[model samples]
Target: MAPPGDSDSSGKKSVVVTALDGVINVNALFTIAIFVGLSLASPGQRSLNSKESCQPGILTVKQLVIFEVLSFSFFLFSSLVAQAIKLSLNLLSSEELAHGFSVVVNEKILKAGMLMTAISSVMGCLFLMISMLNVIEIKTGMLFCGAKSTIISVTFLIVLVVSGLLVYISAAWYAFTHARVHFHRQRTGL
Candidate 1:
């Protein structure tokens, strides 16, 4: 076998590497950045005494900070796990490293990691949707109360949707990588 990330006779990079790169860079990194932004935006000890304070289904700043932290941890771990699996696969393809490593072990790890990533992505989607709703509620309340501006709410909504999309893409990418690895293993009778 040429290995998971190795180029074929055509000299093109393996699909696994390409897909993993896209997921890690475009999707995973973007999602992490969004969470960091959310955490930073948290009002901390500051209370919501503004006009939009009465909005329903809106989480307090403290709650938001906690939520963002959990989410950030989830995606960050998922990204690292995926990277580790990729690296292991690469190592397994190398003659020197393959001596003691079994493809079956790698497959099990990849499968488990993919499942975890998928679950995390689903949770992230739900979180983003909830945040979106909260943003809309705040925006609507502020507009009705004749607040100074809706820019913050609008921006948050945009970010939530964009982050949700990126997380979804990352999940799909993880699934694709899982499938590719499985196919390779099966084909080689590993």
Candidate 2:
């Protein structure tokens, strides 16, 4: 059997699936980049440095940051796994092993990976939003110094929150819809 996109008559792969894969790829790449950026910009254990020197809620900020990092780490892992599965599927396009046990197994694995990725992405988004809120609280509670910096930081946090939400929704919707479409096609040979 030909791969999903190889022949139009096969109808094995819907456009939604293809578009979902593309969106997943883009979001996965962006998430990896965010992780790298966060790692590089991490302030380390500075929050623990002398309570007198730190803000009142510095401890909470530290905890939120840790939580955000962990959630994003899980999201990154899931996204990578999903992307790797998609890559493997693409690599096998030229092979003649399309209608075997392996094909069905791989398809199932891909769907599972996508589902996990969607879940993880949503969790990451929630964690990140909490982290952003913590940052906002910390900023607002600070003295009247660095107002410009606070504004800039708040703007950046809002942007991140909005973008993360968009990614989460898109990823989840794509994963679920693609899975349903795949199931329907398989059942009815559409």
Q: Where is model 1 more than 4 Å wrong at Cα? A: 1-13, 39-59, 98-108, 129-190
What's the lDDT for all of these models?
Answer: 0.52, 0.54
Which residue runs does candidate 2 get wrong by more than 4 Å? 1-6, 9-54, 95-107, 142-190
Q: Give the best candidate by lDDT.
A: 2
Candidate whose TM-score is highest: 1
Q: What is the lDDT of residue 96 in candidate 2?
A: 45
Write model 1 residue lDDT over 87-180, tens digit each, in one string.
Answer: 7656655546444444443456666776676566556555645544334443344334443344456566668777867777786766656454
Residue-by-residue lDDT tens digits, candidate 2, 109-180: 666776776667667666665555555445443323334555676678778878867876886776567544
Clashes of 1: 0
Q: How high is the lDDT of residue 5 in model 2?
A: 34
TM-score of each: 0.55, 0.54
